[model samples]
Target: MPRVSPAHMEARRRQILEGAARCFARDGFHATSMQDILRETGLSAGAVYRYFPGKDAMIVDLAHHVLREVAAVFRDASLAERPPLPDVILGDSLTRAADLLTFPPSLIVQVWAETVRSPELATVLRTGLNNLVGHWRVLVEAYQRNGWMRPDVPAEHVARTLAACAQGYLLQSALVDRQDVSVVVEGLRGIMSIDAPTTQGT
Candidate 1:
């Protein structure tokens, strides 16, 4: 094949992004330097910059990419053929939540902390947070429509509270043991009158 022109550069950017995601997830947003991405992806400095203007851009891409990937996984299952109310919340949170927490829980914590330091990162974080919760919250609203939930409790409130609790647990788990997530997840479940949530497969 002839040498691809710079027009194809965006594809290469995504390639480096994969390496960034791996490094960020394995290490952290701050720890994974541009050099780490270069060595991991075997791309030159100029080439990396051509794709992402700076490290902040790379971090933004990583945050958006991972959140969208997880959201797709949860949204599909949660919106699929299922029961109502409680099942929606469990389906949305359990499988992917456990995986995210068990592995790259730091990703959320890092971005949440970064909001204080970086305005751009904070903007990206807010948008990503809204996207994930908004996507999952649809399922809950559907359940409410079918009379599966109490009318007094709004689906948006449930979604936001759950999002807040889960995000907090990810951050707090760093100071305490990861096992402590049980308390948070259980507490959230109690509010919905459902059994505790688990990342484990059914």
Candidate 2:
């Protein structure tokens, strides 16, 4: 048998993951079987199994992969000499995530739903959330240093809030109405523009 190059192996792995993502996105994770993935990829059962042992492994791997890619977008933006504002950073990150994922962004809704039944998936999601939040914290601190954000507010709090905003956007996009990235970004900017009224001791 001819030996396969590392690049070829990586390509094969990606092919399997992409096919799996499509199935998961179209049907819920529980509904997508190994046979479905094999059929989608047009690869033999042996070939698909060579990369992922089962659907659970594929789900966890896919979640991690998507999260890392999304986090990278924020990481790169945060490291810029003149980092953009929170809204711009978020809009860009979400946009990049939507573009990069082989499946619909709404697919995340199904993954989150599955976490209730799968501890492994839940753990992977928590880790991924932490990783993404860490990058958001960096971005928040950068904003404060640049005087774009109030220094009095805790960076950690702001970071989590930003994460929540992104989550809410995804949930709404999936469950409610599909809105453009700009709409959410504009809302963030509007909220940021408001000046809180001073509260005297009462």
Task: Point to the candidate with the largest lDDT.
Answer: 2
After superposing candidate 2, which stretches have Cα over 4 Å from the reference? Answer: 199-202
Score residue 180 of candidate 1 by CA lDDT.
47
lDDT of 2 at 178: 74
lDDT of 1 by residue, 76-164 (tens): 75666763444344445544656643345555566667789888878877887787678657766767777776567777887777677
- Candidate 2 per-residue lDDT over residues 1-202, each given as its tens digit: 9999999999999899989999998987888888999999999999998888999888888888878888888888878999888888889888977787767767889889889999999999999888888888998898888888789999999899999998999899888887799998999999999887777577
Q: After superposition, how far is residue 127 of candidate 2 from its true place, in Å?
A: 1.3
TM-score of 1: 0.67
TM-score of each: 0.67, 0.91
